[model samples]
Target: MLDERAAGVFTIAATPFLPDGALDLESVDTMVDFYVERGATGLTILGIMGEAGKLSSEESVAVIARVTARSDVPVIVGVSAPGLAAIRALSLAAMEKGAAGVMVAPPGNLRTDDQIASYFQNVADVLGDVPWVLQDFPLVTGVQITPKVLRRIFDACPTCKMLKHEDWPGLEKISALREQEAAGARKISILCGNGGQFLLEEVRRGADGAMTGFAYPEMMRDITALAHSDPDRARDIFDAYLPLIRYESQPGYGLAVRKYILAKRGAIAHPTARKPGPALSEAAIAEIETLIARQEARLSAL
Candidate 1:
């Protein structure tokens, strides 16, 4: 099970799909191997990046079973749902499939600190003893979870073991949580998201590591390893990938870019996003190619 001590890269995995919009189970195995081989100490599946919302309940469980079966590293399954029953159902299924833990995000309707704390308390109750991650991505969820509220949930629920810190300008939240821990509050792992745009700074602000998806998990793998022991070198490597990272951070179409690079790198067979997703234009593809070429040149020089 996941604990507060968890650290290092927990790559948010992409759900592979066939061109026909069907689940590609074989790609699940390959993606797992790719992440693990690239030095991801852990893997987070069915996240927003994983296209979890596009999958049916059965498909979610199937994906969970497949990944848990294939991954030797800890697998954190995103089980966020609108209701406690649904969350419980998926959390139970995930735990049964050998997942190391589950992740839950607040539903958008939450409007108060009490509501937020109560909702997570209810989530912890439903989840029983199964460890879970508190996802704090306000940009997508429209719910801003203050550090005070997070501490309330942590104090109320011993099973809530991690925070998926994705809030923009959330470095202080990390520092505040660490300060709280210093003052003797519950300590939990704080892995950052947001496509790793601020990974270097987040680590400096006391994050455990990255919990976001990118085409090249190795960049995160290497940077996190170098962040402390060789801070300047980490910055150089992070700078080399900044252009591609910035391009892939494009809202509403970032996943397509990431999937494109993943396919190009042979992690998946195709870059198809499901229905209602935008496909890359020829111009966009050319731009990505240029960014990747430049990134490679910079990395080689480094």
Candidate 2:
């Protein structure tokens, strides 16, 4: 079970790009080492945080292979393709390349509950014995895995062991799952997926851990520690970090800000994102610099 094996802070890492917009393997290695050194329990690569949609299939596979080779911790590869065939192929490839587990979104189309359940079942069938993480991001993928549908999928696929719940009313679903488990339903780990903004809240509501994309790995560790060690103290840390989280969560600047922080911390070679996406405005860049400066000063004080 993913929950039993990986019940701590997991980072969904960003993919680093070169100045010419190519995948930077060296930078990827550095980021992997940085996270593992800072206490990440596991690594989720080729995820939304990694800009999975932007990478080619080969690039995605290479990223998974490199991270898996470099890290001792579990590597969960994100399989986010829309079509069932494509997703199945990618999942199999990830498994073959030594990915510890596969994370999947519901079939990209707006699926009916039945279709959604069947989609997961098919993925589990194709994956054979490999563990799977059900990624529940309704806004981006346009499919909602209702509780009833989730029940069906879990019943149908014993290998579907975890879920990354990103639905808006996610805590309600987590509560419902807990109720089901208490009443003899099968146990499945639920990981929070809505960045770090809601991570502390999700843990309080019973999430096993998080798959957030926030820049500061140590801050995330602090959040997790507070959640487990002292709930009230965790809330205090979350509140104190709220301003930085809000700034980093902005739509157009989120990735840029994260990469900038990584660069500032000497974790990555460059803060470049793939082309077709516009560059961060000078104002946004300055804001990120200020945030980075504040973060450094705060960390130094600690």
Candidate 3:
């Protein structure tokens, strides 16, 4: 289970697909192996980046069962749904298949602090014994959870074990949450998750680690490890990869870039995203190649 001491990079895995848009289950093993070799301490599947919403309930369980069976490290499945019943059902199904924990994001309609806190209370009540991660990604969820509200949730729900913090421009929120804990509020794991863009700063502000998926998770591992030891060295490594990080962080286009890079590296056989997501343009592909080239040279220098 995730806890206050949970640290190191937990790679958010992608759901690989064949050229015909079928699930490439073979790539599931290859990609899990790739993350472990590259530096993932744990794996989070069916996250936003993993195209979780696109999968059916049966497909979701199949993916979780396959990944947990193959992975030696703990796996956290994104089980957020539009209702408590669905969330409860999915969480039980996921844990029955050996997931260490499940993640839940607030629904889009939640507006006030009470709504957010109460939503999690319902989650905790429904989940009962299952541990969960509160995904505080306002940009996607449109439900802003203030630090004070977070403390209330902690006070109310003992089962909310972690926070997938993605409130952009909220490095101070990380500091605020840690400060709240220091002031005797319940302390829980805080893993920053904005695709590793603010990883260095987030760690410095007191995030436990990253629960983000960048094409190269080794950078997150190396950066977080060095940041804990030598701040200067971490900044040096972070800057080297900043250009590519920015490029790969595009909202709609980012996943395509990641899939292409993974396929090029032979971690997967195909780079196709599911239906309704556009393919990468020739020009965009060219730009990514340039960024990859520059990233390589900078890494070698470092």
Candidate closest to the true structure, highest TM-score: 1
* Model 3 residue 34 CA deviation in Å: 0.6
Candidate 2 per-residue lDDT over residues 81-191, each given as its tens digit: 767678778888888878888898865765687777777777888778878888888876778777778877887898988888888767788888877888888888887
In angstroms, give how far residue 267 of model 1 lies from its true place. Answer: 0.5
Q: Candidate 3's residue-wise lDDT over 1-302, tens digit each?
A: 65556778889999999998888899999999999899898899999999998898998989998899989888999998888899988899989999989999999999988888888899999999888899999998889899999989988988888898999988999999999989888889988888899999999888988999898989999888888799998998999899999999999889999999999987888999998786899999999999999999998997
> What digit string (tens of lDDT, one per residue) describes model 1 on residues 128-235?
899999999999999999999999999999999999999998989999999999999988999999999999989988899999999899999888888988999999
Error of 1 at 166 (Å): 0.4
Candidate 3: lDDT over CA atoms? 0.90
Q: In terms of TM-score, how similar is model 2 to the real structure?
A: 0.93
- What is the Å distance of residue 221 in model 1 from its true position? 1.4
Q: For each candidate, what TM-score against the reference? A: 0.99, 0.93, 0.98
Task: Return whichever of 1 and 2 wins on lDDT.
Answer: 1
Work out how many backbone clashes candidate 3 has: 0
Q: Which model, 2 or 3, shows the larger TM-score?
A: 3
Q: Least accurate stretch of 10 residues (summed lDDT) in model 2?
A: 1-10
By summed lDDT, the worst window of 10 consecutive residues in model 3 runs over 1-10
**Model 1 ranges off by over 4 Å:** none
Candidate 3 is scored at a TM of 0.98
